[model samples]
Target: MANVLEPYLYLQEQHGFGQNKKSSAPGEEGSDGKRDGEESSDEDNQAPKEENDDNEDEDGKSGSSSSDDDSEDPELAKLLRENSESPSSSDNDEQPRSQPADTERKGKGRFIHQEYDSPAGNISILMIACWTMRFPVMYMDFVRLIEAYELPYLDSLRLLPPSLTLHLTKQNIQALSPHFAPTPMHMHRLTSRLAKLMFRSYNILTPECNAAPLLWRAVRGLQGNPTLYTLTKQLAHTLSLTLTIHYSLAPKLKKLKTRDPEHHKYDNAPPEVSLAATVIVVLKLVYGLDGRKRTPKDIHDPACALPNLSEYLIAIKELEERERKSKTSILSASSTSSALDMDNDMLDDYLDFCEKALLPRENRNIEHGVIRDYFPLTRHSSTPDEGVRSEVFEDSLPDAMSAVRIHENSSDLGPGNAYAIYHTQDVLGSLPEDYEKIVNRAATWAGVEEDYVCGVVERFERRLAGWWDKVRREKAETLGRVDDEVCRICIGQLIQHD
Candidate 1:
């Protein structure tokens, strides 16, 4: 129990819910923040942490957080009450006794948040995947395969000792590539869309994120997924924001004071009761999507885990006690709006939070993205995901950019590195007998000389082992999207709306 609950234990039990709490240790920054709100509520249903060994084993198999259990310790009880109450009694007290029959007439039906939008790169890849991939392909199966295969394969190089990983030759690595990475046919249909989406969500969020958290940090500084946290503050897309509620916002909820009065005829139900009734409402009503359950393995996967996991969990609740306590959930009860917009105050906070981006000549991406500017003509792209790096060095255009180059010649329209990349992708699957066909087909498309294409193809073929080794080393510099692991769960919600 101590080991499991140690991190969440208040840094100084000496201080309770008041202002004097010294922000806990620097390492415990997110303890007060909401990481996964539903997950915290889920804890209430589990058997106690101090149960017998068999109970612990059952809980382990089911995958629940250990610390969410009730504690008899006076300090712990005070802290959980301070941090984990579903909806404060005061929020319940504020509810009206009954809803007017006319309240349903005020419903805002099926909004797309003319204000916030998805990163174009993210939209582009799913479009490509939708358009190109064979129909009847099992999405859930692909998700399962990725979880079972690709992730482990990627980590094998780093986790395995040299003795084993050394023999983890290129042939073995390339063998998995064809089965996992998007196929050549699939990738080409989009013309570097995934590459672009990569830059937008991943690159834009890291290093110098001038658009989002810049506004979020300056303004609300609320607890939510770092992506959605910054996003809810900066932009307010329905799908991303909804997912953020479960993964980040819901867990931080100590108590709520408000609930959506739209779908079920306004009510004064407790926040916990409301959430139990509407995990579906969180991500469901927006897209008719019934998202798959998020599991512990997925949450803990490095790709999905918060960048600063320990500190974010420790520090979040402290940062947003009042925000979380507002209990003014954007929870959608209506089939009409995504529920986020129902509460105009929260929505206003979202739209207005990103106002500083409007200064003239400030290289604005998301700031200008705000619908408030009313300058549709000035905004270049919906989201700031610079696709495809030109060569990974200079001439850095962050349009999801990296290693993607196109020939300027009008006549040739050379494929440049794209051909090489496609060739590499093909080489992963093609046998020697089929190499020429793959090479010639690629040459024809790019309008490049056959021999040049063949040579590029051959170079990759000879050093497939070395190539994968280089990939392993380079990815250390920056892997693809952290959301890549859990995307399948939400892809349906996002793509249909996009």
Candidate 2:
């Protein structure tokens, strides 16, 4: 909750509001027009370095520094310096941080600074409690309701009970989908919240499975009012993006491999459904899709300028191509061995194809590494035979590739033929690997061939992780500063002091 409130101040700052003026007693503004000995704590809430906790001397204070008689403002500076001196100021500096530890709770999982924290808001505290659960009873109930009511329309009607309907409506639909009916503000909020809860629950609560699509239908029905169609489209597009990733990661042919196949069908873990949920949450948080677009549907419609569909598709393609190249070399190497070693090799080939066809090929810049998250399926798999596995992209191939191959293999060709083509020298029967091999060799005749395009993926992974962490930290810090200001205002309202 503190994390959420922190952003309010950021918005205010963005809108050009200066920090709040310090409040003082009636006579405090004195001859110099500055309050003497005013205590101003620095608001750098970056978590403190751990090493500073043990050394009192290095803590932000010079204990022996005494002020001259006329230096009335020195004490305030002293306090600031003292606070800065403390190594653990962020977490444990509220009071004497190095006092003998409270032993009774030490072995029972107690934190050191629990007693010195400032009072927190009751509402915010409740939100914290809710967030802590990750998936709570209410969320589970919602999921159960969604799963039970299977059809799209049926799930919509049943899921929005009267109590839940408090926030249900058509107007809120403007937030995510312009094609949706003009739902009541309340209904829209309820649907949006419910959708979010279900998505989180599906992804974080249960193992990846088929039950996801049922929930998606409920998501789709939220667009009943035609007015929310754009919201629906945006929602669907985002959802598809997410599903594309989920499908890419999920295990292939789960039904054939598992004993309890019924429990994990597409209905249970449909990539599309999960993706839709992902779309809903991301669009809501990052793009403010509903608020900005309102009733607009087109890219230039002015509610908000969304990325062109062409751009998104292009991004998807480029991501796939990188994945294909990364895995193609490995599959080619393995293909030369034997037919019995075909499953693994064929799986890799099919995945390579899916990555190629599904993702957009044009690359403006791959450095952004936005595609990594979606292409996590092709990450190098670690196996005992390091040589064979080393060549494979981090056993990270997406689950959807497996599903597509399974469907194709099961429906049309026998497993042997299916597996054969996947690893066979002939792809589509039109292009022979023998012909392509000579061409590839001829193309690269000038220089000795390098084995693997080493560390390209690893470099991208590192860059992506760093970028993500930076974004999260910066965003969180900005919001933290905002909340601090709000807290200062609240504290002022509660007390009357000089």
Which candidate number has the best TM-score? 2
lDDT of 2 by residue, 1-498 (tens): 999978767644322222322122234322123233453223211111122223423444423233322444678668967766746665565554554455545733343332112111121233224434432222222222222222121214333345765675774333222221211222223333334454567643222322233233323222111212334344333222222112323344335455644322222232322333333332222223221212222232222333322232343344434434443322332234343543664554544544433343442224433344455445346543664465443332312221111122233321111111112232344423332332223112111121111111122223334444554566557677545345334322222122
Model 1 scores worst on lDDT over the 10 consecutive residues at 239-248
Model 1 misplaced stretches (Cα beyond 4 Å): 1-220, 224-226, 230-310, 317-498
Quote each prediction's TM-score.
0.14, 0.15
Specify the highest-lDDT model's number: 2
Total residue pair clashes for candidate 1: 45
lDDT of each: 0.31, 0.32
